[model samples]
Target: MCGIGGIISFTTDLGERHRTADEFAAALHDRGPESGGRWLGRHALLVFTRLAVIDPVGGGQPMVGRSGAAGGGRPEPAVLAYTGEIFNFTDLRDELTRRGHRFDTASDTEVVLRAYEEWGPACAERLRGMFAFAVWDAAAEQLHLIRDRFGIYPLHYTLTDEGFAFASEPKALFRAGQAQPVVDRDGLRELLGYTPTPGRTVFRDVREVIPGEIVTFGRNGLVRRRYWDLPAREHTDGLSETIATVREIVQDSVRRQVVSDVPLGVMLSGGLDSGIVSALADREVGAAAGGDRLRTFSMEYVYNLANFRSDEMHASPDSPHVATMVEHLGADHSELLVTTDDLMDPAEQLAVVDGMDRPIVGLETHVAFRRLASRMQPTATVALCGDGADELFGGYIWFQDPWYVQAATFPWIGPFHGMEMHSGLVDRQLYQELDVPGYIDQRYQEALAETPLTGEETAEDRRMREITYLNLTRYLRTVLDRRDRMGQAGPLEGRVPFVDHVLVEYVYNVPWAMKNLDGREKGLLRAAMGDLLPDSIVRRGKSPFPTAQDPAYRQSLRSRLQTISEDKSSGVAELLDVKRVEAVLSAPSQGLGAGVNRLSIEAALQLHYWTTECGVEFKL
Candidate 1:
């Protein structure tokens, strides 16, 4: 909802800390354009740019409150800075008010400050929305930072001698100089591993607060604690109950997220996730005054011939699936199409690299959305995304492995060994020096080992926890980061209804048999929406976010790779085997082994870009 940044120097004065906080806030100015404020206290100072979501008249942040134990009034107040929307504030506010909590504003930010005042750290459990917040407890001289249970919002922090500095984005923290500019090589390896975990950012020193986790930095030193976890449970609800509950939760989630001062829209892929979100937005906005009918956008390509050149051409047939629901919703719709040339812009690629703070996969569409969002920014400040459905519903192709999908393990947390050929593209010694393979293997093992697998259960059951965990901890976070960076970069707010912590918990606890009853993934969600969406739209199979198929995009990548190889001054030149790289891209991609071309070339290209642009030094 807004951008928050601050610095806490254990041994510094107000003047120095205020200066640093200003820079941090300035770095995030685009995230919150309505208003900006700074709160200077005894030990720490906070600054926030306000988007004016809840209380346009009074809801400016860096909200301060006196700390108290439960109902008792305190001598001093805690200074709080937050960046997110708390959807359940009306309910929380009423309850707190009954409990004798008074408020000065009709804003969720104030409600959150009061909630923390009334319940201490336990306040997070009572919250039900997407948020990442930092509370500077001046009395306790501790900085308490918390991220939502699903990590739908971001909070990156770095520990410094001055104290702990945190912000809504990595760029802000980078500006604060609390963290080094060096890219996190290990994280790059993990991304190459195809699992960019949410908790780790590209900067080694800048770490994101993991979902459901809290960190308190005080004189006792920094302590990280888990405030929540999705406990595995057996689903006892009837089929109908499970279906109805999912529908209700999703509907409620979408309705709550639509509450922004500015107009909002939906990203409709005509897929079930976006379909459901669009339907909910369509219904909600109608009942609310001064709101616009939901605007939806889907990407397409000229001629449909763009497929042959798609940088990530999948032999398994797929297409942009959007028309069904867009027509049904009867909402304002725009299908933005681009040529291979549109996506091949080196400048756009560089912008994406800079936007994400690292070279990334799926940049083509992310960049596309950035452009699309820019066009929509004149009409809307926020857009709802259907990002978490696939991970939560066991919708990946690999999940088709009955054992893997159901085996009480994480479904999307696997070693996509397709990067081996790309590893060959690099000098064997330099590749080993990067220790890319070992680094990637470590992340996967850590992910799998974190899940408790019982041999007795079906593969779906065993992998349930792991898959859901990966969705929440890794994939979902990446999507959130992408949506947040892209949307905010265009000065638009991005909301993910599927990442609702309450719904995530509910889905994770649903019995595997119920989740994919009769061998259909996401069967529960489909049944839940029974009549809300047209049967055709609800029944459509899952398709990942749309990507370009333009042959020029592939050619562009090839050209970029060639340029990287020929540019002897490029840092990546030392690590790459020019001959092997040429052979891979020059040949037909069909003969590449399972998961080979997509994974390897992507990694090789990402690595080359990182070394040349991201300033990532290849150790080897």
Candidate 2:
């Protein structure tokens, strides 16, 4: 629930670096409207913009504490600039207090500092939550950058000739002048392809801190090490026991994340994932709040019901199911219905593109996130929802497709993504130069190699491991990054219980057979929460966040694409095949979610504006 940025460089004057840190923090002020601060030293500077989700009146950063070079004994200066919530901070604080650590603030920031003081980098292993933090260990004269196990929080850094700079968003790093936003070949592939390569962003020199990693830098140079990862093991629990354990772990994560100093609610999608979380939250939080009920929210397009139809991707619109859940739970509910006009507003769509810091296409659930966050910010500071569930529980329909499951490349890359659908629109030579398929193959191989493996496993089990790994590492990051941007853009915090590392580790090793016990996608999760939810929700097939289905939206997009094509000065002009574009404009609208031409138009326009806004220069 905050923005963190800093630069650790030996080349710049201390005052100069301090100034840069100020600018870096200023760039992300929207993320932390509550308060902001900066910490400076001879060779290190950390800046923080905080939106208080816990201990609202206290726990400001860059918070400083005392520690030893070896993490014990004589105290010396240790500065911390941290973002994201640590759900286990209360317990850790108690344990640290027992060990004689004194506290002046009732904040998780202090616990994190104390944890590092007591256990050094090993503290990351004992912590459970979403966090991206940078600590200046004055004793060791080294800086440490750490991200959570699932990469729920984003942290990007670029190493420079003098040192390195890190930030909550890549745009902050660009503002700090640590790196420029230039599109290299790989970056182009990443922008055009479904998922970017892990650790690779649209900016050439910029690198995202890989999830579960702790990167440290000192006189010895940079050293990156994994603090956590999926642990492979055999499943031994019976089906009933496994389901029971899943229910327990998931509820624990939800209850733990429900902690907040401000008002909170749930993003009720009406599907099983959000439904399960909202039900548990209502039960637990309702009891704690003296019978007060939980608040829930959902979104829809103005003419969605009229235009929406059952399709391969969406069985039905979310409105009806959402209504069922809201009535069933008897929770306070608000449904925001948006029009195509609201979605196509140039300023708003451009802002979404800039917030993402890449050439992302379409405005499906993403627009809902931003619009809902804006509306909810006044009432709720934290909103919990169901993400990471599908990836973990095999919920995506494509997961059930044997063709995708058996494919040599990542299952979600080609067909599921429509990766090659826009190739014809790209300047043929430029498209050939991007080598999209080659890039996918390489990154897919890299992901496969990184998947944790048990000593021995069945062919099906092994294939499942690869597919799950693809979802966890590649697909999931894209989803998480997008949500974080929009949620924080509203200056609101979004939490996902489904992403808790403990639950993820346990469910990961469960056999695919048990995962689909009812011969349905995400059957295990459905089984676990069945008793708490209505049969309508429990039996409902998986649905993605709703996409605008109105024909007017398609007309608006085509008009914009035509306008962009007419202006040869547009950034995407180099990528377009003029004839192909004409065909796209002339092609019949595919109504709602089914058309490739419609999507291509949307993608082309978004990419053009994103490139222009980010000041990107293509290497090719």
Candidate 3:
């Protein structure tokens, strides 16, 4: 893994423009600590900070091709700056070699450059990995940028009058002077009410290159086009065959992502996704690298053992489950215990939103993982996360609907299905003042447009599609974004093996019946687990990363709300009435569903925090 940044221009001075690229790359230095370089030309420049993952000694970027420009029978010399790992590079390289493409380095980055030279933009469709790359065409004066199909790797860009500026993170663009501090109101609504959908960021002028999409720039101006998307296909395979295929694809993905020079590990949540990854990685890598087994990391709160409980609706606590899986797998494991006080720190939410560039749900667990990354970075350069499994395998309890079973695709829509619960929790004027309906619905409509279903698509498939679509479009993006920021913030590279293209494609076509065979969510996945994970862990219901259940966390949030109320002209004050907030705080029964005691008070606090601290000025 590495960091990529660049500047493309038609008339901008090459020497001066190169400085912008340098600054952008510098801002991402933590992402690539091993080596760095810059590629410069009259009309274009590219820069890279490489963390020596694959071909440690040989791979470096901005990697310029040895050949000269096309025409005059000369091969086109393309310079590439990339940040990611191509898990299937061995196969890709063999195909490229058979086609007479010479190689000087055993690096997937080079394979991609050669592949692009051979297939142009079409190359992305054949690639199966998490990547964000930018290429400069010296002769054509054109620049090309592409992102992975699931948007696992982030690439933010800003278009200026002179040319285009891009980077692996928004902060890099800001540092390059291509970005100004403009806030998008709709983006704020999404971040506060729902997960910020893929392809949208907090920054107004900056845009994310969509998953499976390519954006190109030249004298004609910028053109954006989709290179890949989820193919709507009818499932015909039996449950057994589908499960077998899923096992093969997932295992291959895990094995391929273990191709780093630096030590690697997995975030073993003791759930099926993480457990499967840990088991496969320990077996595959231990065999390949002699006795070096996969390392594992997990987090639990202090006093968690006492607070742990399980019901039919929610699974048993993750700590014990994760412990059993780690012991069964016999992998080197480390667990960090955070206190409710640690999670309830006054400034923790602010730190998260500041680093993430937006507010997100599940804030406490996100911080815990980040703390784990910082601690484990001494022994691991990359950490694998099992993020996409839930979306692909119908793992969300909300997705078990019989209606979704018969529907064509994603049935996870209608997230705001029951706002009526808020009617008596808070005053009517407060509900109207909050205007959660107008704000949330607008963002929801925008998200639906991003992954619209056709008439030919079934309701079951549509629901499944919506779930996985939102996973890719929102949930997964948020997870990957948090992983990148939190991990790379400490110079650690976080890899998501489940987001591999091959695995994603296999799951995309598997029918909902296969995903949840025998009335079990992710039943096929469990069947495929075989000897990798214990049946107890495999059959366990989903438990999100552990967070504090203590009342201290709630009080911490209420304090922040109090602070927000004190700041008379704060952006958070505009939407939330002070009287309503006081009333809600006094009642102590709002912000949650009926029979649900504690609320997502921290989430509400972060919403207020984003407005005041992040300057998310509201237009509503």
Candidate 4:
């Protein structure tokens, strides 16, 4: 919903960087173009750019407030700059007010600031929402960075020679001009290896604030304390009770999230995840607002339907199902049809990397949608989707496949190993030094250890839980990041009720048997919302976001790669074997395979563009 960045230290350069923080905040214009501001402290500086989704008139950034418990002589330690939506701000506000807290504005930002003053870092435990915020504690001379339990919001920070710098997006840190977008050997490995090593990022010095953590940077150095984590416990609820609880929590999350001062809508797909969100949103919005039609949007490739074939990931084109739901719900729907040229556009592809500030493993669709959303629904600021449902409810094909689930390492890597060569063309010694295999295994073990697999457990249950945790922490992290970058680039705020901490925690503890009941992926969810949606939608199988299947798209990529290959002084040429690159390009591609060749070409092209355009330096 907003962008927040700041620098803290005894660095004298604050004079220039404070003003540069303006550009740092300005770089996120797509994320929040409505308004912006900067606040400078003797030893700290903060910046905020806002979308103004709530109490637009009253809420603005780099806000300063006194702690509720501060004594008359004590210094007011807390100054807050935040980005996110606190769905339960109203409830928290009332409780704080009852306890003698006064408010000057009718906005959630004030409620959060007051809550922090009243509770300190402990405030995160009492709040329920997706948020990333910074609180400068002047009394302690400490800077605090906090992220949501599941990390739905993005926060990255790192210590510098002068002090610490933090930002909602990595590019903001770059714009601040303290840290370079230079990834070293290890950063390169994580970038290409397809592993989500918590805290590690593509930039050598910049790191993500791990989910559920409140990290404090001060004179004593950095300390991290986790505020919440998934608790493993025995399932006591019967099938009926579990389903009822799922329905209740999920409905409530959607109910709270749909509240917005700006235009709000749902990102609809034929899949069960988005369908259920659409259905619940429709009912909730209708009942609350005199039966207005729900607004929904879906994207499709220009000739995808004509070229579509049944694959492991998709059973049918989304057109028919989308149509069925549009008519069934009587919703206001818009379909954006994009050509292969649109998907392959170098500028659009470049925007994807620019938006992410890394060579991320996401589809080109994310980039296209960032532009499409603005054109289709310029007024729509908030949109909800079912992002984490697959990881939570076992909707992916591998979740149901015995062979894939039983593998030792992360389930996705083996099948997609070839794609892991994001920097395959890099000098061989550099690639060898990356130790992609070793890095992936190390990260996998770290994640597995954090998963509390207590009590007696069957091999099946334990393995499934590990797999689920991997998807939740790693796969889902990438998914959420991609969604944020894309949606924010559209200047639209994307929310996911399926990622509600309570819902994720509850469904996580449920036995796999219930989640995949009757041998179907997401079976419990289907049964819970069966009567609410048409059988056609509830029965629709999982389909990954659609991609352009046209050969022309592949040709466009191939041609560009060929052109770059011939350039003797190409920035990417030193790392690549031109003959080998030419061979791969000449090899057959149906333009539809989701395998090594497709991904390698995509990654290589992306890396080239990013390195050349962004002028990324390899400090290796």
Worst 10-residue stretch by lDDT in candidate 1? 310-319
Cα lDDT of all candidates, in order? 0.71, 0.83, 0.72, 0.80
Q: Model 2, range 1-620, lDDT digits (tens) per residue?
A: 79898878666656555668778888888789889999888888899999988898888899988655433573677889999899999999999988888888999998999898888888999999999999988778789999999888888988887888889888898888888888887778887777767677878889888899998888788899998889998889999999999999998999899988888899988899999999898887853345677888889888887778777778988998999998887888888888888888887778777888875655555666788888886778899999999999999865888877888887765454553543536776787777877877888888889898895878887888788888998888878877788886578888999998899899999998999887899999988988989999999999988888887887888888889988868888988877677666774533223334555666777778877776777776
Name the candidate, 3 or 4, with the larger TM-score value.
4
- Residue 270 lDDT in model 3? 78
Best-to-worst order by lDDT is 2, 4, 3, 1
Specify the poorest-scoring 10-residue window by lDDT in model 4: 589-598
Per residue, candidate 3 scores C-alpha lDDT tens digits across 1-620 of 57888787777777656567768777788778778998778888788898777888778888877564322223658788988888788999999888878888988889988887877778888888889999886656788899988777788888887888888887777777877655655544444455555567766788889888999998899999999877656667787788788888887888888777778888888788888887777777753346665688888777666876664335566777878987786778888888877676656657777667665666787677667777787778888878888877778765775654443323333333343322222234645665756765666566666664555666677667666666666666766777887776456788887787767766777767677778887877888884677778867877666657666676666676677668776665554544546654665564343321233445556656777776555443
- Alpha carbon deviation, residue 520, candidate 4 (Å): 0.6
Question: For each candidate, how many residue pairs have backbone atoms clashing (under 3 Å)?
Answer: 22, 0, 21, 0
Best by lDDT: 2
- Give per-model TM-scores: 0.89, 0.96, 0.88, 0.95
Model 4, position 28: C-alpha lDDT score = 67
Kindly list the per-residue Cα lDDT of model 1 for residues 475-549, writing each as its tens digit.
676777788777765577788888887787788777778878667768888877747788877666766666666
